[model samples]
Target chain A: DQQVKQNSPSLSVQEGRISILNCDYTNSMFDYFLWYKKYPAEGPTFLISISSIKDKNEDGRFTVFLNKSAKHLSLHIVPSQPGDSAVYFCAASKGSNYQLIWGAGTKLIIKP
Target chain B: EPEVTQTPSHQVTQMGQEVILRCVPISNHLYFYWYRQILGQKVEFLVSFYNNEISEKSEIFDDQFSVERPDGSNFTLKIRSTKLEDSAMYFCASSEDRGQGHQPQHFGDGTRLSIL
Candidate 1:
């Protein structure tokens, strides 16, 4: 079974526009969530994240909002730039040190 | 500025051959992990190690796979007998702290293993 899912395989947005990527999870045991951006042939780079106790967390151009009741979360990028083009993965873990349950990932294309 | 480092950016091995992938995690990190992503698929967890022992492993990690921290700084994954299905990008990750649901794991560029 897919514990975490990113139904949308890909997303595209214009430069300077707001882009949103969504993810969902079935495991209620998950207590922490994270987003990672990956470029081809490179390891994934850590993005923003939110604790289960908090609904939202923001850093610079990235903001992650979690709706625990809905078992869903979204990452929002303000004024998205071409450099933001990459595959974004959503992962969840139940404990602070538990294994990560990853989503299939969403490829974001920021059109210049 | 510490980052996980994986050797042999790409490897191609024949079926039934044994292969070992190596990684050097951050100096101060106490936790290490191995994850793999098949072509066009989500990354999946294989195992996590801490204090020179395995802390957790997933269903995908079977008898054919083994992990070892032979030295103070090197972590290695060995596949006793490789199979075609083992082709994928293997990533190494590490975390300074051990908080299951909270801390971020830094990853290496990954070694793309191509089993023939």
Candidate 2:
């Protein structure tokens, strides 16, 4: 069962533009959410995360917005760079739980 | 910045044979995990380890799969009688104490296991 779903299999955006990736979850018990970026042949790299108590968290050019009532979250990368072209995965876990339920991932392509 | 490291970038083993994948997490991290991703499939969690014991595990971690911290710097996943379906890219990850807050997990490059 897919508890976390990234409906977009792939997305292409122009460099210097904003790229938005969306994620939906069926489990409301998940209290913490995170976004990870992965490149070919490399393991996933942690990008950012948000707690259920918060609606949004931002770091540099990346911002993650969580809508707890809708069980949905989105990651926004402003002024997307070529380096941002990678697979983005959304993961969530409940209170103090070590296990992270992950999405299938969205392949983001930044075109110059 | 310290990062998790895994050994044997690629491994090829015959079906039914035992295989072991090794990892060394960041020195200061306290939590460790094992995950695998099959070709064109989502990454699946296998097990989580802390305080020298299993903290959590998924159904994919069946009787044939095992994890160990053989040394202060090493964590290993041993598959006793592997099946062809077990062939996948196995990743090792580590995170700081959760008591502070939700610490992001850092992953290793992963070892690609190919069961022949």
Task: Report the Cα RMSD per candidate.
Answer: 1.3, 0.8
Q: Tens-digit lDDT track for model 2 on A1-112? A: 6899999999999999999999999998899999999999999999999999999999999999999889999999999999999999999988543788889999999999
**lDDT digits (tens) for residues B1-116 of candidate 1:** 78999999999999999999999999988889999999977899999998778999999999999999999999999998999999999999988675443678889999999999
lDDT of 1 by residue, A1-112 (tens): 5999999999999999999999999999999899999998899999987889999999999999999999999999998999999999999998766688999999999998
Local error of candidate 1 at residue A37 (angstroms): 0.1
DockQ of each: 0.74, 0.73
- Candidate 2 C-alpha lDDT tens digits along B1-116: 89999999999999999999999999999999999999999899999999999999999999999999999999999999999999999999999989878888899999999999
DockQ of prediction 2: 0.73
**Clash statistics: count for each candidate:** 8, 0
Off-target runs (Cα >4 Å) in candidate 1 are: B99-101
Query: What TM-score does chain B alone reach in each candidate, compared with the true chain B?
Result: 0.95, 0.99
